[model samples]
Target: MNPLLQASPLPLFDQIQPEHIEPALDTLLRQAEDALSTVTAAEFPATWQAIAAELDVATEKLGVAWGSVSHLNAVADTPELRAAYNTCLPKVTEFWTRLGADERLYAKYKAIAPESLNTEQRQAHKNALRNFVLGGADLQGAERERFAAIQEQMAALSQLFSEHTLDATDAFSYYATREELTGVPDDVVQGARNAAQAEGKEGYKLTLKMPCYLPVMQFAKSSALRGTLYRAYVTRASDQAEDTAKQFDNTDTMRSILTLRKEEAALLGYPNFGALSVVTKMADSPTAVIRFLRDLAAKARPYGQQDVADMRAFAAEHLGLTDPQAWDWPYIGEKLKEARYSFSEQEVKQYFTLPKVLAGLFKIVETLFDVEITPDTAPVWNPNVSFYRLERVGPQGR
Candidate 1:
């Protein structure tokens, strides 16, 4: 049996591979379709438990299996995995679009009278109805076809954007001498040195990855190094020929995403994408959400202004730096923190190693909750990945 189709308490991440993706998804999708057929049949039970146990259970398992593959593709991204994910993405999207637009399933749920159900079951039915409406359940002929096409296009565009962004980020590198790395953390310097040694290079190797870039901005004494990294980070997936490499450019992709989103919103009878987006969100409407954001900006404007002024003053007085640029902000901020708090970030970082941090986190959670959280060993795609099991503790010991 394929490990992807295994019946484990959790995902078999270690055993799952790019080759298993298509076969597993094909099997799962078929299973889900079969379950849907049974649930929408004439003789199927009208009760909530009957529908949920018979159909929802199988569908939920498929969702979980697919979710694990998606999650792995994001964090443990590789060329093979990316190809596999893209190949299966369209099939998954098409399956969902068809399932959502199924009037027969919607009719079955609608036929279940709410008065006969409990509070939870009744609320679940109501939610299901609302979702069905949003899923183009009532759309017919051309309109329904357009809606499904929009969904498929959106899925493909999203995957393309993600691939471009990741590829662009991974394509950059900045090798620097030891002297240029002044004020940077020892651990960061060590990490870069280790990377260079792996490639049998002379100087430390720096990449556009957050772990390497952040410390350089905050602590590297070389202004040129900081500027180089800043431009690379911001201009990723951009069409700037000089500042950026222009490879994996997503400028056109961004425009297409916005355009498609607006059309999708219009099809759904909403003013814009924002309005359609906030329907299932906490904000009641787009206008209210925009107002709330503007209010927050107003409240924080003074603090931001004060911080800028302080940084300007500190640069002029202490560092002999008159004009501070975008790249200088983090460096100046770090210096300001050290001066004001009587401590450096390097000093603070020494005590907060990963193991210690995890222990502290566990201690705090255990103190607050009635559940016991324990470290769990699992077969993971990445060595760094860790899992934990949370168990309920009653009066009697667990």
Candidate 2:
């Protein structure tokens, strides 16, 4: 009865129902346990190549299920979906950790002939060996148990941090009556009006989503309105008192994650997680990354300073204001741009409808890659969404 392992013939497991996730996960977990046991109990020479191949297949199957469930939870969150996802994530992590910590499996992989593998397979085996070593595969008795406990606890804490951040982001909303929305441009004002109507309200309602909020704050000419939005954005997660939750505050969670990551890295024999993570990325060291950022800032500093000076002078000349506040910056900048260039962003936006924008993007990509994307008319997750298949072109200008 597992949803993911169903016998239906829908590509990408499209027929998977939400109701089947819990039972499917239970079944999948048993299968995973059996696979791990079988690998660890093998008597013959257990090769890293064979072990890694099995691991890849098992992980891929479980990963498909986890990915679908997680995406559903993010986009269409309900209590049922949320509960299933939160409960399942830790189980998945524990399975991965258990396999990573298996000493017999590690020993078998360690015995593989390096000369027998190709370039890619050799790299994969080496990565597999590194994972086992870092995961404490060589530890015995109490040390192994302690490492498992640490990994599981870390997984749970990371989940808790993300859930708290999502809750905080979703909790705040603002409303402004038509009369109070005096300085907003007509298209944006109309958009807010439409939004209010959709929600069965008489006034505009602005939430934290970029589509609903950022444009209003950036273009609203009223300083009071901009300041209110800016303040809400910054103080969202502050603690009002000891017990009460302030607006969107993520302070304690941020501190918790930082401390946990440092501790976890130290336990794994790394100086810090930054080195553990970024040593594999394009930038080799923290010093190099910092230098890159500093160089960019230095390049930008003169133009930024001159722009700030020009804005202050313009605001003083037009509004008779001696001091230019941060709240006034966006509105005045827009005005300056329009006056100097005789062009407005809103006018440009009129020609770039969403569908037109997407079509243009498709054309650009097609020209670069020489691939074709034909739209399929099928029932999809959203009515506005379209699905395209990327087909490879043959060589010799096919």
Candidate 3:
């Protein structure tokens, strides 16, 4: 059996390969399409449970299988895996676009009587109705066709943006001499050295991955080194990057995404994308959200201003950095924090081992939620990922 087609509760992560993607998705999508036809047939009842049993089950399987593929692509991307995902992306996108905008299915859903549903069912039905509208179920003729096209285009563009970001991030590397790595934490420097050795190189290797970038910014004594990294970090997937990196620039992609969003919003009778976004959210409108943010900023402005002033003074007097640049803030802040608190992140990290931290976290969660969490076995893509079982802490101990 294809691991993607396995009946296991969790995905068979270790067994699923790039080759399995197309066949698995083909079968799942066919099943989902068949289910949609079944549910929307003239003889079929428009009741919630009937449609759910046929349509929901098939679609859920498709979702889970696709989600697994997407997760693997994000965490453990390879050229083959990426190619497989891209090949299948448009098919998956098209199916979902059609399903959401199917007028027959929408009519069946409309035929479902709200009075027949219980409290939970009613809420679910209400949300589904709203979603169908937002999904362009009410659109007709050319407008509907355009809406579907826009969805597929947006999906493709979004995936392209993600690919560019990941590629840009992975493409960058900087090798620094031991003298250049001065004041960097011991573990980080050692890790960098190990990376360089893995590639048969002499000096320490550094990348923009957060583990290396963040600590380097905070603690590296070399201002030039910090500046070099800061520039690369900020300019990834942008035109500001070097010639090779400029190929991954998202400037045009971002503009196209925004243009499509505006068009989509207009098609759905929304003024702008922001207005459409809040329809499913708690905020009444975009204006309300903006007002709330402005109010928050007003309240926070004084403290933020004071913090900057204090950091500036500390940088000028103690560090002899009268003209601190953007890259200097994190270093100055860390130094200031260490001076005032008489502690550093490096010192704090020594006390909180991974095991100790996990124990503390689980203890707090178990106490608050009245549950017992225990280790359980499952196939994982990575060795570091451990599975756990959570049970209610009751007399029956389920």
lDDT of each: 0.88, 0.71, 0.95
Sort by lDDT, top down from the best: 3, 1, 2
Which digits, one per residue and each the tens of the lDDT, describe model 3 over residues 248-325? 999999999999999999999999999999999999999999999999999999999999999999999999999998
Candidate 1 residue 208 Cα shift, in angstroms, is: 1.3
Rank the candidate models, highest TM-score first: 3, 1, 2
What are the RMSDs of all candidates, in order? 1.6, 3.2, 1.1
Which is the better candidate, 2 or 3, if ranked by lDDT? 3
Instruction: Please give, for residues 19-73, the per-residue lDDT of candidate 2 as tens digits.
Output: 7777777777777776666666766546655665666566666767677777766
Candidate 1 lDDT tens digits, 1-398: 78879899888999999999989999999999999999999899877878899788878878888898899899899989988999999989988888888998999898997888999888788888888878888888998999899899989999999988898888888789999899899899999999999989989999999899999999988788899889888888888734556878888988988998998888888899998898788899988988999999999999999999999999889876699889988998998888888878788787999989988998788778877889989889888888888887879978
Top model number, TM-score: 3
